[model samples]
Structures are given as C-alpha cells and as structure tokens.
Target: MRLIIAIVSAISRGLGVIAALCLLSAVLSVSEMVFVRYVLGHSTIWQTEFTTYAIVAATFLGAPWVLIQRGHVNVDILQLAAGPRLRIAMEVLAALFSLLFVGLLAYAGWVHYEEAWSNNWTSETVWAVPLWMPLLPMPVGTIMLALQYVAEIMRLFVEPDAEDGASRNTLFSDTAEGTRP
Candidate 1:
C-alpha cells in the first residue's frame, strides 16, 4: 500500500512538472506570436493554437498535483470546525465523490481520445496538429487524479497522522506534516 501511494505520488509530481513546462511553453509561444505579428510584420500560424492547447493541457495534467497539494479552492470552514472523526468522515466522503467524478471523466476522455486517434483527427488550421496530442492529457491526467484519490483515501485510514498528501513547499510527497516518507 505504501509502495503504491509512493509511486502514484511520484507520478503526480512528474505530471506537475510537465504541466508547469506546458504552461511555460504556452507563455513563450504567445510572446513569440506577438513578436512575429508585430516586430517581424508577419502572421503567426501555430503559436495561437499551441498556446491554447498548452494551457488546456496544463490545466488537465496539473489536476492530480493540485489535488495532492489541496490547491483547489474550497470552503474549508467546515473542515476547520469539525472534530477529527467528523473531519475524516467528511474528507472520505469528499474523496469518494471526487473519485467518482474523475473516474467518469477519465472514461469519457479515453473514449474521445480513442475516436480521435482512430480517425486520425487533425486541427482545421494550417498547422493541422493532431487532435490526439492534446487530447491525450485529458484521460491520462484524470486517471492519475483518480489514482491519487485512492492514495488520499488510504492516507486517511492507513496513515491518520498524515496531512492530506499535501506539501506546502514541494510539488510531491507530504514532507511538511511530520509524516514518515
């Protein structure tokens, strides 16, 4: 169980890094587009589409990292006010619901990706990027999120003292909550 959690956390952390890179690449591409359109007096082809896809990809791929970090915006007032048992219960219920939602999303995304890949879909632009390239992250990231949710559920029971698989400083592992590695 520990090994499984550790491996999933490692994968989530890796996805976080990749997502950050995607965001950074998007930013750079947008800048390049502006430079080409204004400074070089030329029209851009792929940069606009690339930026959109990269941003979307980052959002999807970064979800597991966000979940582990507890970075998604939520009203934690109830959590702060509840007793330990109630808190655990609430957290468990929430995790289960989240797991269900992400699981369905993953299935749908996989189906969509399969169709795209099978049809060899491409963008209707001059760049004509393969649709599957961007679509790949949807199912992949959501599945990772689902696995991370399981790890989170386990952490609640198997490691009660741990802090929700969250690290304030790092993108991976719960190093800040006095939990054993």
Candidate 2:
C-alpha cells in the first residue's frame, strides 16, 4: 500500500510539473502572439488555438496534484464538529465519492479520446490540430486523480489516527484541534 501510494505520488508530481510547463508555454505563446500581432503588424493563426489548448490541458493535468496537495476548496465546518471516528469516516467517504466521480470521468474521457482517434478528428481551426492531442490529458489526469483518491482512502484505513503526517496533511492540518483524528 505504501509502495502504491508512493508511485501514485510520483506520477502526480510529474504530471504537476508538466502542467506547470504547459501553463508557462501558454503564457509565452500568448505574449509572442501579442507582440507579433501588434508590434510586427502581422496576423497570428496558431497562437490563439495553441494557447487555449495549453491552458485547458494544464488545468486538467494539475487536478490530481491539487488533490494530492489538498489544495482544493473544502468546507471544514462539519469536519470540525464531528468526533474523531466520525471525522475519519467522513474523510473516507469523501475520498470514496471523489474516486467514483473521477473514475467515471476518466472512463468517459477515454471513450471520447478513442472516438477521436478512430475518426482522425481535428480542430476546425486554421491550425487543424488533432483533437486527441488536447483530449489526451483529460483521461490521464482523471486517472491520476482516481489513484490519489485511492491512496487517501487507503491511508484512512491504514492510519486511522492523524499520526501519519502525510495522511493528515492531505486531509487535515496538524494543529492540535485538527489532529484529533
């Protein structure tokens, strides 16, 4: 279980790096586009499409990293009110629901990608970029998120208490009040 979690963490971190690079590329491309269009007095074609795709890809690819880092927004009022055992149960339930949601999304994304690949789908733009190129990130990201969710659920079972800082960090803070469970 520890090995699985470690592997998933590594994958999520790798994807996070790729997502950051994609965002950086998007920013640079947009800057270049502005310069070329305004300063050079030339019309840009691919920059708009490329930047749009890059930003969207970055969003999907970064989702798992966000989940692993507990960067997503959460309403912690109920958690704070609950008892230790209840808090653990709530966390497990949340992880399970997240896993289900992401798993379904991954499956749907794969289906769409398969269809696009089979039909040789391309964007209806001047660049005519392959649809699969942009769509590939959806399934990959969701799959990684699902794996992270599994890791979280496993941690709840393996370490019910908040002694394991990694597990606590993902679900809750290490403050005295927060570490009760």
Task: Return the TM-score for each candidate structure.
Answer: 0.87, 0.87
Count of clashing pairs, candidate 1: 0
Write one digit per residue (lDDT tens) for candidate 1, span 59-177.
99999999889997777799778755566677888899989999999999999999999999999999999899999999999999999999988776665354555322222344433
The digit string of per-residue lDDT tens for model 2 on 1-181 reads 8788889888999999999999999999999999999999999999999999899889889998998888988787998788655677788887888788889999999999999999999999889998999999999999988988898777665554544443433344544534433
Local error of candidate 1 at 22, Å? 0.3
Predictions: Cα RMSD each: 6.8, 4.7
Error of 2 at 100 (Å): 1.1
Clashing pairs in 2: none
TM-score of 2: 0.87
Those runs of model 1 whose alpha carbons end farther than 4 Å from true positions after fitting are 160-181
Clashes in model 1: which pairs?
Answer: none
Error of 1 at 55 (Å): 0.6
